[model samples]
Target: MARQRVPEGPPPAPAVQKVSVRYAKRGRLRFSSTRDFQRALERAVRRAGVPMAFSAGFHPHPRISYANAAPTGAASEAEYFQLQLTQQCDLDALRAALDESLPQDMAVLRVVEAAPGALADLLQASVWQLDFEGVTLETITDAVATFMDRAELLVTRMTKSGVREFDVRQAVLASDVVLVRAGDADGRDLVRWTMTIQHTTPAVRPIDVMTGLTELTGLQVPRSPLMTRLAQGILEAGGRVSDPFDA
Candidate 1:
């Protein structure tokens, strides 16, 4: 086959300014996958009339970079991404426009001039909160105790590459159980499991931690336990997650 001629034209304008955004995925929007958010964001960017930079190739794409997206079916307060723009704009106004353009449940929380580093490199850990209904606080506490005591807890998850196993314990830095509500009128108990986990390859998710708990102590996790990412950033010396935007 003969070599195809490359499309000829002046290259697209280089990015003039880059801004990092922090958004929230809450309520029913949490069920939407990463690709869904990407599509929605691209549309929102157009609707908001932001001057986005594009690639030089024939099929030029928006210069947006996503970092450490939260898993599907989990709500998050600290989802982050960066956008390269062809022109500089007021961060506050851009944030408001984008927030209004997005769906009701997904809201833009913060927009700041990106610092001198990759956003992904700053996100070293995540703090997650898992709320379990129909389970006693004592049961979850015991399970967490058992999970923390073990030196290693291997769990399996089915991926596109088939069954994969990894030690969830190694990624877990700290964990605790709290009683959200004690014996409500419907006789249902709500328990919250808060944990700080280090970001690692094949990232350990809240479901994996629950699976490890079940495996270690025969704890029954609720089928629809609500999982929310409270924060994601650099892991500090005292096991706290520092804001990446503040870096």
Candidate 2:
């Protein structure tokens, strides 16, 4: 077959600078998938008049890199991405504009000049909060104890590849249960399970840990527990997750 003729125009402008951004997914917007955020961000960039660098191709796309997006149906206070710009711009201004352009629930929390290292490398762990309604603190505490006592706790999740099982216990660094509210109008107490988990292959999600707890102690986790990623960054010596931007 004859090769297609090349276009006559010059290539797209190269990126002169890169900026790392931390954003939040809150409220109902937590259900938005990663692709949904990508589309929203592209529109927001254009709306904000960002000088985004584009790849040289028939179908040019903005130079944007996303890392460690929270799963669908999970809210997050610390989500991160990077943007390559055709020219330098004031980070504060860029952040304000982008935040204003995006939906109110999807707020741009922080914007920093890109450092020398990979952002992914700094994101070594995550702190998650899972809130369950109608669950007692005692019940959750017992379940957590049972979970931690085990050498390994395997759980299954259906991925694009297929249903797969992995040890959820291995990724867990620390865990605790707390009572958030004594009782609601329905006379159900609110309990929260907070955990610090190391990032691992085929990442063990909060749901997986819930499954492990359920399997071990027959603890009934709410069908749609309020799952939120409180923080994500380097795992510190004391099982703390430090800010990636600071690293």
Q: Evaluate model 2: give its lDDT.
A: 0.92
Query: Which candidate number would show the highest TM-score if scored against the true structure?
Result: 2
Tens digit per residue, CA lDDT, model 2, 79-194: 99999999999999999999999998999999999988889999999999988888778887888998899999988889888999999998999998889999889889998889
Residue-level lDDT of model 1, residues 40-127, one tens digit each, is 9999999999999998767999999999999999999999999999999999999999999999999999999999979999999999
Models, CA RMSD each: 1.6, 1.4
Candidate 2 residue pairs that clash? none
List residue ranges in candidate 2 displaced over 4 A: 1-4
* TM-scores for all predictions: 0.95, 0.96
Which consecutive 10 residues in model 1 have the weakest lDDT in total? 215-224
TM-score of 1: 0.95
